[model samples]
Target: MTAPLTDDEVGKTVVDAEGKELGIVAKVNGSRAYVDPNPSLTEQFMASLGWEGDDEEDYIVTEDMLESVGEEIVLRGEI
Candidate 1:
């Protein structure tokens, strides 16, 4: 089991295995979070922080993907 992360330690840079910028942590909703990946990537992004439809609509990223948590937001390798 992993220790719980705090809100203060959230918003950190999420880099890939090769140290590539993915995105910044937006917010944590439930068991997942909203990772706004870099615009350069072709992946779609959420317009805001909330639910939309059948899909979570918030770019639901799991905590396991988290690479590091900072004073601002959480960081994940990829989502």
Candidate 2:
């Protein structure tokens, strides 16, 4: 089974299976990672250890959609 995502994922870049840049991980709650498509420096900094953000534009990526996690986080399919 695949391992769950952690708060360490915050700030990491997220991409689709085709390598299309989707966004950056802003927060991680349990197995879900919140992606901020256009985050400011302050928003990025405030995403410490899974603290939730108030941005309505942010989207959620669940563990089932995760493909891999390395230099960047890659999703199994398009967003």
Candidate 3:
């Protein structure tokens, strides 16, 4: 398993294996990252897309799905 994402991951660009920009990390909680597919939203709205919400619109990326992390977060496979 991959290591958990840190708080710094928030706002980092997220991409797929092919390097397609999927979204931005809206929030980080332990091993999970709440991704905002629509990056144009305000920071306040982005932060609301959390695990505690019942909304299915929010996307989640786990540590195991990560391919690499640097200036951006790349997933092992396309979401």
TM-score of each: 0.45, 0.81, 0.75
lDDT tens readout by residue for model 3, 1-79: 5556987777788899998888778778789888877755565354444322213455988998998888889999754
Candidate 1 vs candidate 2: the TM-score winner is 2
Model 2 spans > 4 angstroms off: 45-54
**Number of the candidate with higher lDDT, 1 or 3:** 3
> Can you write out model 2's per-residue Cα lDDT over 5-74, one digit (the tens) per residue?
9878888889999998988898888988889999888876776444557478999999989889887898
Model 3, residue 73: C-alpha shift (Å): 0.3
Model 3 scores worst on lDDT over the 10 consecutive residues at 47-56
TM-score of 3: 0.75
Q: Which segments of model 3 are wrong by more than 4 Å?
A: 44-56
* Candidate 1 local lDDT, 1-79, one digit each (tens): 2235433223434455466666644555555655555421223232232222223333545667665544333344354
Best by TM-score: 2
Candidate 2 or 1, higher lDDT: 2
- Return the lDDT, model 1, position 72: 32
Cα-based lDDT at residue 37, candidate 3: 79
- RMSD for each model, in Å, please? 6.7, 2.4, 4.2
Highest lDDT against the true fold, candidate: 2
